[model samples]
Target: MKKVLFGLLLAGLMSTTQAAVAQSGSGPAVSYTETVLAAEIGKEILFRRALDWTENHFSYGPKTGAKSDAAAGTVRVTGTGKVTPVATNGKELTRVIRFDFVFRATDKGYDYSVGSFRVIPDPQKPEETMMLSDYIAQLATEKGNGKTFNDRRVTAQANALASEAAMSFRSFMNTMPAAEENTVGIPATE
Candidate 1:
């Protein structure tokens, strides 16, 4: 009976699930990349606020592609990801999850970024893990009852990615070549 239940649970939980990935360009991204991102309502709002009071940015890395002749060039980016629960509780009441992120970026003919990654869940979230496990287990048995679950999951994912992406960009752009880092401090010992 336990084996039958586990099999049915796995089958149901796997069928309706999808994954998400949030990424950024690394090498020779075009200007439109930021423009495209700024169009997002959440991003625009966050960036506007971030720019107002933050003095952060990314140092410009070496350019990878040829110089643009047509005013501005373009970039193409892609990512593949999978989020899977790594471990299930003895009673299937707890779960440890891992999100494998495989990402790459290109511009014209040059490669920008490529990497694989994962999400390491917080250790203190054992209770949340148990709750999620119960939810997934329920999702398996309850069938269409996951309507609310799906909706909540989608909204949570969207908001999280948008928020994180915006913060990352705010930090990144503040460190670039042209960013002014105003400070008053004694020079550090070398």
Candidate 2:
């Protein structure tokens, strides 16, 4: 009887954990409908993710410095970014992050960076996760209060990662040998 009661209690507790935080997924891979050289002019990244939102949404579109669906080249990028507080100095914090963007050929490749791609915010937690490894320390405990949510340290760290990802892609687009285009493919598809 004691075992049965404990089992029921465990089940009840697990449900609340699901309710308190956002879920992470393997995410979508970047795919393109048109070849880079054959893309149109204004087409953009047109894809979504598997996360839910309730409030304080940070929806982004195109490369307008803010958020818009209008894109310059043919590729449309759409993905989710999570921010977790690693270290906080008042309102400022560092963040660890992981985001996957699906890239579809729109018209043509543009000068914009992946950072220019849309960032879908997780309203439930605000802070999101990119790679599973970042939260290894948090996962050990079965019960997490989502202490990582909107963690500025995590956010800053993740943003920095995104910036670095953009630079690597920039280098690939401009510097990769033309003959390797087929072998290497789109710069941001990874």
Predicted candidate 1 versus true structure: per-residue lDDT over 93-184, tens digit per residue: 12233211111112212112222122223446622332232334344444443333432342234334333444454455344332232232
RMSD of each: 17.4, 16.0
Every model's TM-score: 0.26, 0.28
Candidate 2: tens digits of C-alpha lDDT, residues 1-190: 9999999999999987876543532123222222244232223322111011101222432112223333322233344444444322335333323344323434454333343222223335634433333243333332432453333233344556566555544444445344434544556754
**For model 2, what is the error of residue 46's alpha carbon versus the real structure, in angstroms, after optimal superposition?**
19
Runs of candidate 2 exceeding 4 Å displacement:
1-72, 80-82, 86-109, 115-151, 180-190
Clash totals, every prediction:
7, 30
| TM-score top scorer | 2
